[model samples]
Target: MISKNFYYQLITRVLGIVVTAIVMAFFFLKEYNALGIVVAIALIIQTSLLIQFTNNTNRKIAHFFNSIKNEDFTLRFPENLDIKSLRELNSSLNMLNSMIQKVYLKNEAQEKYYQEIIKQANIGILTLNKKGHILFVNPMMENLLNYKPLNHINQLAQVSEELHRFFSNIEPFENKLFQFSNEREKVQLSIKSTSVMLNKEELLLVVAQDIHKELDKNETDSWIRLIKVLTHEIMNTITPITSISASISKFFKVGDSIKPINELTENQIKSTSKGLDVIKEQGENLMDFVQSYRTFLSVPNPDKEPISALKLLDNVRLLLESSNTNITIKTIVKPFDLEIFADEKLINQVLINLIKNAFQALENRDTGGVITLLAGINENHTKYIQVIDNGSGISEEVMSEIFIPFFTTKNKGSGIGLSLSKHIMRLHGGSIIVVSNDIETKFTLLF
Candidate 1:
């Protein structure tokens, strides 16, 4: 196939030959015709210029096609070609280049979007090939495992010996959850695996989540349910016995029926009356104790508000002060104003109970034995109030039961004060922990 430039060169050569043939004929037929010779020479010079122009244009066109072949679209072809045929070719090539560029840009954008979603996902996502080779892991997976995905994907093993055993036991396993613990941290993860077909090959997609908080909440709820069941049973037995005994005592008042029968019956009635009175009193005490339990569980969903530590301590001190001036209650509040979000009423109850216990624990100690109340914050960013006693400290055995319902060391104690106070703290999303030795026992309320 001859190019447009070749056709132009052929046409120029043909014109020059024809003009030369005419000049030669004129020279032979009519000698010394200078004008005809000059015209022939001019046509030869004009053809030479046309040939050079065609050669240059062809070179540029070759370079343009070579650039496109090399995927270099930066080379721009001439749009305004003097030759109509080549001009149409240039327009078609430019349109094709523009279409290819648009497709490349769209593919690049989609690749970037896919990677961005993987990076931003909250669920810990991981991919494992059929050969158990980890192919991909996101940032969430790295964060949950406390190991960077960039470092340990294909090389590191995700399952431990225990988890491996559990997974191997399932036959033709579909999706399954396996609990795993890390050797590096106090973290537990539930890994759920689902096999997916990608590129006509099987791969596993593992989704992991940390369930430590959920487990802790479940255990706490179980304990509360057990305690409620026991309290209900105890109340049921106590209530009926007290009521029956008290009604039986009214039989004694119907006397004078039989003389001898009346005396024996009256004596029996007196004993029953005394027994019934004891039962009734104990039942009422039991009811009050149960009421306290209800109150502990019924910690009004705290209307949490930021409160100053100093003000909270002052309120506790005012509530604890009595007419007797022997006991010295010292408040060692931090100078800086520490604020915490908590229920003021519930916190005040916890502080006051600890204060009263501290004072009571110091009953036999020397006068002015200080019951120190300290308020501060811990490193975990949780605020705390500590009540320290300088009198007779609580024994280890008693400390264990200090927060138990109806367990008290005092002579006339209901034993629900500390228990109720601890529950109140828990309801406010906090806790009360007691640590005691023979020297000093401290009750720290953490909020």
Candidate 2:
């Protein structure tokens, strides 16, 4: 309808101009010089009016667009114009501008909301361009660094030179730990970086968290667990020694004084000898336990080399099978050539430990126990080996203590296997994790 109205107005104006020119020509041809001059003047006025009318709409549209480009929504075109086409055009533009303004306001509000969230976040967040220009740094980040108004990565030198170097050389999609001392306290930051594209510009989005408290808590928890296990193991050995020593002492002592040798019975002497032997055995066991603990604490750095995952799994399967084959053993290596750069010996120890645990978990099952030795790359493109078992799975209560040294449910278990495995993985810059249910258990060694 608006188009029709606009075309009608345009056609009418053109017809008027054509008719005025024709009339002016006729007057001139008839030799009516004064009338011809008057008609020619009127024709010029009509043509000027038509040009102005078209330019008016064009100017309004251009101005509206310019206002939008500059993010200014204050420009309002008059809707009470004499022409219907002009009035309708003005109203439609006003409506469109109003809608766009509302959307702009909404988006602005949302951006502000997100910015507020970032500002109040507990963890530190910062974005840097390739030139190290800090695009955005939240208040939490400033607080964490103990330096405000952080405008560039180089400004990290104001906090610590080492921190500046860390930021400068940080790699994307990797986690790094940085420790530095400020005036207030020692800060242990767990930092991670990733690439983010904003407005067609690539930025390094780095998130840093003050993990000092968490690390302290974890250290304290680990100490407590170690103490508990140590106390339990030591007391087990010590209590027996104490009891046997007490019993043997009674054979020779009378009211805290040594009895005469002639008064000692043969059975008493034999009992004393047996008690001494028992004490010696317990002392040896205690020494071995301490030695194991020492070994756990002294895990050497990995001698890394590329080792085929399939070969590793197969070797472990063969080693475990040579002793017992009651449980069905299976090997799975994805892509047939997946490999890991790690100490082959240390990795073998970890795999053996996990596979043994799987064997133990399935030992009680009568007929259908299955242990799967799975080797592959995980979703993160990290190499991993899984020892999965279809058996009575590990209970949650036992699972929590499985990684603690000398904490075990088995009667004869020294409880060093899983903990040692975890330590070896840690040395290799890897990790071990376990998941279990009533029907199955899986231990994954990630590198």
Name the candidate that leads on lDDT: 2
Instruction: Report the lDDT tens digits of candidate 1 across residue range 147-258.
Output: 5643434333463556445434433334555556777655566667777888898877778766775689977875785576457557755876867775664554456443
lDDT of 2 at 76: 88
RMSD of 1: 20.8
Residue 38's C-alpha lDDT in candidate 2? 97
> How many residue pairs clash per model?
0, 0
lDDT digits (tens) for residues 1-447 of candidate 2: 677888999999999999999999999999999999999999999999999988987898899999999999998888898889988988999999999999999999999999999999999999999999998999989988999899998888988999889999988898988899988899999999999989899999999999998888998998899899889899999999999998998888899799999999999989998999999999999988888889888888898998898898888888887666678889999979888899998888888888777777777777787889888876878878889999788888888889998888887768899999998988888899999998888898888
Best candidate (score: TM-score): 2
What TM-score against the true fold does each predicted structure earn?
0.47, 0.80
